[model samples]
Target chain A: MRKNYFHPKNLDGVYSVYQIEGLNQDRLIKNLKNGGLTLYNVKKIANHKMSLEISVKQDKNFFAIVEKMCYTNLELKPKIDKKRKKLLKKGVIATKSECGYNIKLTRVHGKAYPLYYLFTHVGVLIGAIIFCLGAYHVDDYIFSFEFTGSGNVVENRVVEYLNSVGVEKGKRFSEFDLNVLADGILAENPLLSYAGCLKRGNKMVIELVLAKNGTDILDESIKSLSSDVDGVVKELKVYRGTPLVGVGDKVSAGDLLVDGVISHKDVQIETNVLAKVVVLAEFNYTFISQFDDRETHAELLAIESLNLPVEYSKITKQPDKDGYLYTVTLYYNRVFVAG
Target chain B: MSFLESVKEIIGLEQFPAPVFRATIIGDVAGFFEGVVDVQTWSDEQIVIRLKKGGFIINGKNLYLKKYCAGDLVVCGKITSTQRI
Candidate 1:
């Protein structure tokens, strides 16, 4: 029961109508005035029943005061009259009866927490889980391997060689060190002048630049044929340049059998030396059978690596018995802490 | 004059000489009365009020005191009957 309970109808506010039964109009008026509340309107509908429109300021405080007056009337005795008076001064509703002064205030509404907060918290947790899973998928293992180069070499053969050298695709993206893989490829193959590997999205691209060998690319240049072994040249076919020595010529290793320079009208023209030579040689050799003395052994190797996504091991057969022991020593570097 | 009559005179001079005790029944739910000297006996179902003259008995279900100030008394419930004792 506060003076602010009733707002002007044209204004935006809340008001409550309470029926004060079993009480006289005078007494009711006096109690409300004492509680610091001005009754906006009081309509007597019966001899003992009246509709009271009290001015409400705060809903919680107003409702609590009303309820305390309604339900705790019997408890508002002389012993707690002082407390009751204090509550009344704060605009609490109290009425006197034969039993005692009791309070019966019914609450209709106030500041309550909305029910959607629980669902909102749960939704946020689920969203976070989904985000984490999506991040893991996007940054997961490498999807495929792509090889690019201009060479006469077979693509499958290069891919297999790269796999052997640990430049494999489908491995975890974080575990791959592109610089190290390129270095390893260049080291293993002397015919490749350039080798590089890079990641594009989920795909790993390997680039190779083959070194120009004489048998691959032929152009205008000076070259000489050298015998690979001690032999007698039975015949010769020169496709370019000049033929220095004819058939039945005996040539040793490192001897120039053809020349690539031609002189016409005192102008020397240099061209690539190209020729095909057949050689006949005689040799005596001794062969030994070591199938009975040789042994084949395989060892299952498993390793847990830190830098690698998953731990893996393979059973590699030793080239010789000593090779197995050497491979076991290399296993020490594979074990690392998992990310 | 008795002490109860003196209290009744002081608290309720406006309704004086009309009735030593006046009880007004509102349907069967509530009762408003004056000239209450003291609450002699009380319970959820029955309440006895010592008025300036004789006492009054209020009978009902869920009967509760709504307010009491000096000689003014308001009792609310499913008030069935009120009898002069």
Candidate 2:
């Protein structure tokens, strides 16, 4: 006869075991069915000696009810073998006979899913959301300009100059040749000594250092002098030699504004100090103007994965009349200066 | 072994006095009685044995068998019986 026994290798869900005595065959079968135990094979080896094999699905608390029911049986002297006792000592294993039908019941009850799969799914979703947000927040393309020296220049004139040379605010710094732009702006105004253009993060900065022109002085040899240009007298300074013109007198260019010689008694002393004065002048001029009134837009061009370049609208000027016109151009760039 | 040789061996040429030399304690010098090349005699009742680091002074009241002189070896015990090297 071929002897057949339960194979531990094949029983993937067996965790622990429990031995029970004084249970009638009929009562044991009834209890097994009521307890939701799915018996795989039941063989009666001898008088009251039976070998029962079963299986169950994996769950966290599948054998809890069976454990409680077995404890309540007062007449049952459960003698567990060494293997079953060792499994019971571990405290988490569900025996084959107790775990069988309960495994199916738990499937119906909706449980038993791998935890790693759930965590991985959540991680992927979070990663995708973060990636999208980063893409939206990134400012890839940037261009700007800046100005230096005295900021008290006419705004419209600078803007006009910038527009004429295609160096407007929204335009990319790389589009304009910085050296050529500097030369053009300096050519328009001889008063500016050095003009520079550069690019910073999202901005273009332009710097202009003004020429140091000497102020006009007056000689005290003149009898009287008055201002030729209309202006508010800001300051009046006196030389120690002689008075060419008294207080409250306005003088123009090429006029003897002050006297350096002083006549006292029989000696005439010549002083070296030159008289200086400052006046705030406002020159008023008018000319006809025309504007496109069209909204300007920018276009971005990616140079590489990290670098981006941009372009802007073109500007054209139309002649209106033969008169004095003030044109101001402001070109912004990002720049650094060593002090 | 012969009796004479054993007797000579028992009574070694080097004699040691009782109350073997232990250690040294420095204090005010009691007046000097005599001075020699390898030894010095003090008027006080103790004798001092000089070492490289310090000196060991022995009291006359603890002196047992051997007589201590200004230039004597002043042996306290056999060299092997001494606790120090």
Candidate 3:
């Protein structure tokens, strides 16, 4: 059997090349062999110098002997191939190299590249972030208003009504209900028949339509205004129907004051239109004078929608003292509402 | 084969006291051998290796120990001859 000192285990992991030029190089080789170090490619090129390959895994032991023996005339530079490099990374490794400087090359390169970019382009990155933030929130505010209509509309009233309903410039449009805003616009202006609010790309579009009169008369059936009470007409105003009785005309009950039938002089056809008229009749309203005076509906007349409007007031007899008569005129008009 | 040699082969026991030694020269490019006890003499031209059975002298040009592991060694050079001394 071969002795253990003659051939040791394979020392092929992470080796380096070294050249030694000193006196008694033979002694150095002898010391290396006796120290149980494996050597490869031991060549003698000069009389007192030789070069050899030794494993880097024995860095501390190999350098300890070299430094102790004052072998200062030697140079060692690690030459790594793929197989030896894998061994150094996985299993056998030297903590600090004696052949080179005490510096780590890979860690510095891995950490510095990112920090360099971050420190150099900080302003551009911040600007990009702010731009993205503004783009995300731009849809909340309203900027312009565009009004469109078929007829003439008061633009200022629509704008004012929208602002009063909390739909204004720079306000979040979603906070205000669109339906309420549209209804308020129609109510504030009596002239507008329809009001619709449309939101399109940060702009509010108001659509207005004026009321078309005389076009919505579904019942063109000939109608007339008849007096329900017997009195004298004090004031009379006609807006649509023809007036049959003028002011100071004595009218009795069941009398037609305005005629809906109209006969044209040039045309042969007779047209029937709805009668919209206002008549004020004189009435002697008498009330018992109590110690407490209370207002009554006898004086005030609203003239609301009624199928049968009062065209005259009848005075029966004069009351004695407490029943003294005073005149209360009432306004009666047939208003034709077209929505 | 002798009786002890064949028994040792069958039992997988290594030949003791005198290890086997053999040398192969491949077209003067390299030489390989095993069971070496020591590197006796080394220079640029020759290297004398001592084995258990005997010793060997290798003469060549630019001869170096390519590898030595577990008593197995390789020598590469332009070899003129190899002789057992």
Candidate 4:
């Protein structure tokens, strides 16, 4: 219980208002304030109205007396507003506007507080859910393959080699070794003159240029045209004529491995022809050897055990040499020996 | 002055600064005017410029400017061009 004193011009004396659960305005005012109180201003609060600026004699226990008088012998007849009562009965006005204020305060505070909190909380939750879903479903995060060079020569071979080396679509780019794989692909397919591989995001892209065809092979028959180093003919291809030698044949470095000779002296006229031959002359080599003796020992031996009524014998021997050795004597508990 | 020196001066006066001239600078003098010279000594594609007082050969894409003689005034599309032919 609380008491407040307020003044009004219409009132003859100061009005002391009792702020309890119910309304008993006349008695509350009369009991709270004696005849000596005088009036000044009035204002309305949540459940009731009261006046302020009332004059009272200053005393040590004045506030205590007022508080006691407001609470003592209180009778509450709820002065419910008829409009509010009608709205409540009809259940139509869920929220009520304060008489002078622009904002509407809900009649049920518990329901309104959660409803307000839910609006913002649910909005944030829904936004977070949408963000997560977008992050999960978006395909913008991807691997990209970038290629370079003229379209005709090296592009197809590079792409084919990249695919063969397990860098196909949908594979992560980090799994590939760009330089090693590029070098490997170039070495494997001689047609690719040069190749460079790069990884971007989850994609592997290769750039390559093809070696031009019709590059001149040295005419060794004309001894003037020869390489400084002697090279065994690992392979030989005759574009204009037949091959002179099969695989594993030897020929000198300046030897005419490919001959452009024609035998037109015969009755049958021969055309200008070329022949290819393979040669294997000499090569530098090195050899290496490593062996372990422990493995060989384990493979040669097996364990054997024999048991009698009161004793046992254990032995380790090779598996294949059992029948050759004869048992000449046997000892029982070191008492007697027999064959 | 000698006859060659007079002829050189006259030729320099007559032509557009005698488009091509050879100058040799060794030791400390090499550092003073390094990148200031823009001369093409090889084909027009290959231009010799100074970098850190050392010669740098820049290979450009176009080669048409190579045909001009040593002292000829070679101009291309309003760009003043000179070279040591």
Best by TM-score: 3
TM-score against native, each model: 0.25, 0.22, 0.32, 0.22
The global Cα lDDT (0 to 1) of model 4 is: 0.37
For residues A282-307, write the lDDT of model 2, one tens digit per residue: 23222234432221211111112213
TM-score of 4: 0.22
> Across residues A1-339, which tens digit of lDDT does each residue of candidate 3 receive?
754432212222335556665556555655665566676777776765566666644544565666555443222222223553554456343323423212111111122334333333577667777888986577767888888996334576677667666777898777877788888888887777888888887888888887665243366565666777666665555544667887777777778877765657865443454444333433444444332222243343322222235564432333445544433444343322111
DockQ computed for model 4 against the true two-chain complex using alpha carbons: 0.00
Per-candidate interface DockQ score:
0.02, 0.00, 0.22, 0.00
Q: Clash pairs of candidate 4? A: A6-A51, A6-A52, A7-A40
Candidate 1 segments whose C-alpha is farther than 4 A from its true place: A1-121, A151-154, A167-169, A213-339, B1-85
**A42, model 3: CA deviation in Å?**
1.7
Candidate 3: the clashing residue pairs are none
Runs in model 3 lying further than 4 Å from the true structure: A1-13, A23-27, A67-70, A74-339, B1-22
User: Residue B38 lDDT in model 3?
Assistant: 70
Write model 2 residue lDDT over B1-85, tens digit each, in one string: 7774576569873354322222322232121212111222221244444433344444433222121233223232212112111
Ranking of all predicted structures according to lDDT, beginning with the best and ending with the worst: 3, 1, 2, 4
Model 1 TM:
0.25
Fnat of every candidate, listed in order: 0.00, 0.00, 0.37, 0.00
Candidate 1 residues A169-285, lDDT tens each? 567777767888878777776678788888777887788888776233444454656665455676577776667667777766566677777778999887677666655432212
lDDT score at residue A160, model 4, on the 0-100 scale = 63
